[model samples]
Target chain A: MNNSEYAITVKDLTKKFGDFTAVDRITFDVRKGEIFGFLGANGAGKTTAMRMLCGLSVPTSGNGRVAGFDIVRQAEMIKRRIGYMSQNFSLYQNLTAEENLRLFGTIYGLSDREIKTRSQRLFQDLDMESMRGKRVGDIPVGWKQKLAFVAATIHLPEIVFLDEPTGGVDPVTRRKFWELIYKATADGMTVFVTTHYLDEAEYCNRVSIMVDGRIEALDSPDNLKKRYDADTMDEVFRMVAKNAKRAE
Target chain B: MAILNALIKKESLHIIRDPRTLLITLLMPLVLLLLFGFAISTEVRNIRICAVVDRHTDETRAILERFRNNEYFDFQGLVASTEQNRMLEEGLTDAILILRTATGNMESQIIVDASNTTMAQAATGYIESMVSGQSGNSPIISSTLYNPQLKSSYNFVPGIMGMIFILICAIMTSVSIVREKETGTLNLLIVSPIRAATIILGKLIPYFILSAVILAIVLMLAYGVLGMPYSPASIVNVVLFSLLYILLSLSIGLLISALVRTQLAALIVSAVAFMLPVVMLSGMIFPIDNLPIVLQWVSAVIPARWYIAAMRKIMVQEIGIGFLVGELTILASTTAVLLTLAIVKFKSAVR
Candidate 1:
């Protein structure tokens, strides 16, 4: 399995676009099989730092490891073991849900039988069997969100990164979507998700609050709420994010 | 290889589902070829014609002087008869006139490159009228060279091939790639283990195959329905030339995809910035010689100018492959440059 105690580890990871440091020397760790929340206001470098961790972009200066593979030199190996869903809900809308699953699974080098069995298991777990053959564009946005998760995890990747997977999703649907995330982590698959919504941070095993390209606070949601003298994660986030210099 | 197949399969699914890709690649060629073939009949202006005088005299000088001063033609001044084939074949002039007093009387013969049917027709008409309209006119005999049939479709076939190949291959490929960028799927692709070059190849191979089908359909219609002249001996030439031209068009699409981040912008640039010039200035429907000086310079770098011209030699004239050396070199080199630029730009753009 090659599973480490920590699914992701980083030290002083920084990403600069010219003089502007979008992700500035931030450090964090995500334990294996836990729901790790990455929270920030818009344009606070959540996407950039997540991209660096997911092996999508090179860090300007620092270090990162995902699933025991170095982010810089072993990016390809990291990619083979991880799945990603981008901020905009990025499955093929033209393809049927099953077909999208098949496509990603195949890209991860899964056999037809393996893709089919995994797709069946996901559909059953989500109770989305009736909609499996329907085109993703024909489905509702919440369903598309769930289908994207299925596509990302179809190959049984060790870790999955979701950039605002619940953005634009209804509040009730977002809560329901958490059930699937819980089930995934129950199977020992690590999840790293980014969101601007502080309410979602309450559901994480640990949450990091980033403000203006730096992580101001990182801890369990309960610990952050207690430390900030707040009753909710929203207050904790507001306490940290109040001094942000960057605009959305 | 499995990863590539998966990508190709996914890309093919996108191509099949998006009616725009199919509509452009499959139908654009047929419609443009048919519309331009029968519906359009435009008179050429500023026909560049040069003359070869065997022996100079007062009468011949007067005749040459009239053409030189005429507004309807850009006279490429007195060239030797030995330079006759060189001038027309290299596109220095549309046609050449052979004038002589070695036969005792002024016997003038006109030779126009039949590749450009409209310009050839226009140039031959103007020179014949000029000889007859003059005072010391001789026994004038006219002949259009290259191929005898000179079907008007010869003009439209090459022109439509140039316009629609760019429109379909470049526009569709660019829009498809850019659509991924717009939908945010390209970020997902980058996160995958696949290299940028593999992604590009998977995206392009399907279009390249579709381009081959479109080429076959276009050629079949041109040779069979429109009665354009094509010899059996030039089949290999047509195949090789079409393959090279398709590769060039696909690379242009890839470059466009790398430059633009939005699908709408890709479509607009491919259709307007590129295809429009091919139609307006590639000697497709209008004469390049007729364009203003600056536009003439603009048309000079247009690849279709060379593509349509060479297609004429291969499809219409059925000339030897040697005749297309200049056009082949231009297309091949441009393709190489564009492919390199596309790969480099694509890597940076995607990241």
Candidate 2:
């Protein structure tokens, strides 16, 4: 595929913290409009890698581009063109769901009229209209996770990054959250999500399992399972993670 | 500009929704004013005195009459010398005056309760002037300028203004920023397209307006309740100086927030780091000149020291800007340095 056809491309991307390398010589390409899942055990450098791609942290040595902008030189441009959500629920709990939506929309340079219309439509589509004026902290955890996703995507960027967005939710809510990811893909928006739940890996179009700052395996889940002679993604994850050398 | 407006709006909502912040903003000034105005005073009034005369000469009667006419002394008539010590011990009289005729001259003796040394010294001085009619060889007339009654509250109003503004602005801004950091919202903000400088400014603007409102309340209480002299020029000067001081305090808070990770740590650091300097080195409760040379040098760098001095000149002395150029320059320069440091630290932290 041509360079323009890729949503993200990295060539030898590396990040170091003093004597330790968090992401070492990583290279991959995320196709446009694909739901790519990043799988890693605890402290396997998934977050450090995502932080570099989102332009929140500079890479120690390497070259990378996200949404066609250089991650290091054009961080501000990358920020304007992408959305990000963390596991901790980044919305202001003191603010209402609608207020969070409006604030993020305005930050992304949306007009007042656009914010009002888009917020109304987003809430209706999510069936979260009842939460329009309620404080985020007063809502259930499942509902807050959904609202945070809406807040992150309010500007409708070309790509969205979800860092463990379904952490600590019930299985039913986790399933519903994936439905939102699929909906974004249906709209032709690329999704780069990180998760520890191996079962969720099966839903992704492609998956990269990292162990000790290196991408140990990258392919479709079916291919990984067949190649490893495993019956399930969990067994495949155990096989990949057992080879990690980093104690942390 | 739109992003800034949105951020400011969000900050304002946080302030409004949090009852603790509203309480501090609204009630703290009034509580502090009443505390300093009424409870913390150094003025001495109505000292109790008993007179003992060995013989009732017309001269002695006339002298006793003089003491009775003065408002500062509350005269308790004719106690025997034996009862003088008893009255003082019972706290009935603060002092005793004894007059006797020896040879052709009238002799006088004053025994005062010296437990509170300042008040004792002042009472003795008053008795001596009344008896001798003059302590100096020539009659000397003295007049008090500005605050003629020498009200202790006058000395405290400027100090209270300096202390309250710094405490509220510094503590509130630091805690608010650290709260966002602890909640992980600061990370969200950093990832947004808004500039770092804009975010810092957005955080400060609400506190700026709130500090201004608190300043106005403090000034109103100073003039209305404490009876501090007020003029339009003095009001302008006080407002201007307080604004500069508030800006400096907000910058200090921002600096602390940038360095600390948790809201509790931010609160403790801001309180310990700022309160001591503001109260001790700022000349709020003690005179800067009276402090040790080392402390005096430290006071020169404290923003509240200059603010309290400038505020006294503007509000009480009613001086013009020309007289306060040195103080205003120091405060303005310090504010610039702190704000630049806070912004630089914040940028690096986010990166």
Candidate 3:
């Protein structure tokens, strides 16, 4: 396959801690501009796989490329091209929204003029002009999550990895967050998201369900549901999880 | 360069916005100066004493009168030698001066409470001088060269400088970094394009600048309020030594943050492990030479020991760098070793 066609390509990627393998020879490919949902039970090793692909953790063995850079040898190059938002809200709570944006913008190597204009556009996009000067700790969790997502993609990275981005929030807020993800994909930015919420899995163009450190299913949500003979993505997940060898 | 600038700006904003950190950093030096300067004093003043004369003579009476008139002694009246031990046990008197006439010559004995050895030594010296002065023979002609009055504050000021700088720079920096780790922001920072070394140096720059500011305030109070000697050469020495000490402290903080996983652990370790050693083993309060041989060997490893010694030489004696090369070299090497270790630990931790 042409490397430019895929934002992330992993082959037999594995990570082990002592004798226990956290991720056991998982393989997958994510197309550019695709909103790929990585769904897993709590200990299914989804986050470990994402970490390896983000160049944050080393794979025990196997080959992986992120943004056309080798995950092992070109980790620094990969870091420069991709953005990541962790499961926890990672922005500085003491800093104002504008300050956080300025910090991430500069670290991402954006020029002063670009940071200024892009931040202004971001504030307008989120309808958060009033929050530009507010400390992140003072903001609601929903707003913080949305703001964190925008900050992660502030430099227009080719791929933005969101690890359980909408973990705890109201349904309406989670819907609004998915809208932002859709907007990024529309702008030709790949969205690699991990979520435990089965309902959110339906929003992805393609979904992979990991069980027992292995991908049990990877296809469009419609195809997964039809193949499992299930009515909903939740049923599809349940059908796949029954075969997991590792206990939750 | 841009990444470092952004990090520094963010760190500065954090310091400014956090009232607790700001309050401690600003007020610690002044508070410590007052506590160490006036409260923890070794200088003897108005020591309580009882005079016991078994066979009174004109010379004994004259000596008693002199003791009564002296300002260093608060005469607690005459006591029988049999009652002296009870008076001392009840804390009525700090010492007893006994005079006996024997074969046309008078023999004097002084019994002192030596629980606090430094204060006891000073009191004995004072009594010896007063008694010898009345014997028509001049007392030992001794003069304090640098500090004529022998103020304890002069000795404590440099030590306070060492303590305050290390406490603020090392403890604060480590706590701040570990706080980021606990809150998970450090992971985001590591995932960014900036190098780990850049992140560490960026975090340290603001602290270095803040420490310099604190040093300036402390020196001002030392010279302005406490009457510590100030000269251009002394000021240069202070600035140079303080900068080196700050670097050593920052690197130590970085090493701690790299090793610890939580903010609470960082706070506890920096306080008990780092701050305690500076206070007890740095010769800040107790003299290193007076410490046990084992502790003396341990003290040689503490950067604050060399720092406090160098500061005293510079600020009090107004000495040149020729006298401080050994201390400066030790401090520089400690900084180098800690910094290299911190960088290596941080790199591996990031991975």
Number of the top-ranking candidate, with TM-score as the measure: 3
lDDT of 3 by residue, B1-351 (tens): 888988999999999999987997899899989887778778888999998888888999999898888888898888988999999898888999988885579888898999878778999999987777788879467778888988889999999988887788878999999989988889888888889888988899999999999988998889998889889988988898899899899888888998999888988888898889999999988999899999999999999999999999998899899988999899999999998998899788888
TM-score for all models, in order of appearance: 0.84, 0.90, 0.95
Tens-place lDDT digits, model 3, residues A1-248: 22589999999999999998989998999999999999999899998898898888999999899899899999999988888998876899999999898899999999999999999999998999999999999999988998899889999999999999988888999999999999999999999999989999999999999998888899999999889899899999998998787777
The digit string of per-residue lDDT tens for model 2 on B140-224 reads 6668888798787788889988888878888899999999998888888888888999889899999999998898888889999
DockQ for candidate 1, please give it: 0.63
lDDT of 1 by residue, A86-170 (tens): 7768888888998888888878889999998888988998889999999888999888999998888887789999889998888
RMSD of each: 9.5, 3.1, 2.0
Residue A115 in candidate 3, Cα distance off native in Å: 2.0
Query: Which number leads on DockQ?
Result: 3
Ranking by lDDT: 3, 2, 1
Candidate 2 stretches with Cα past 4 Å from truth are A1-3, A243-248, B46-141
Candidate 3 residue A150 C-alpha distance from true site, Å: 0.8
* Interface DockQ of each model: 0.63, 0.75, 0.83
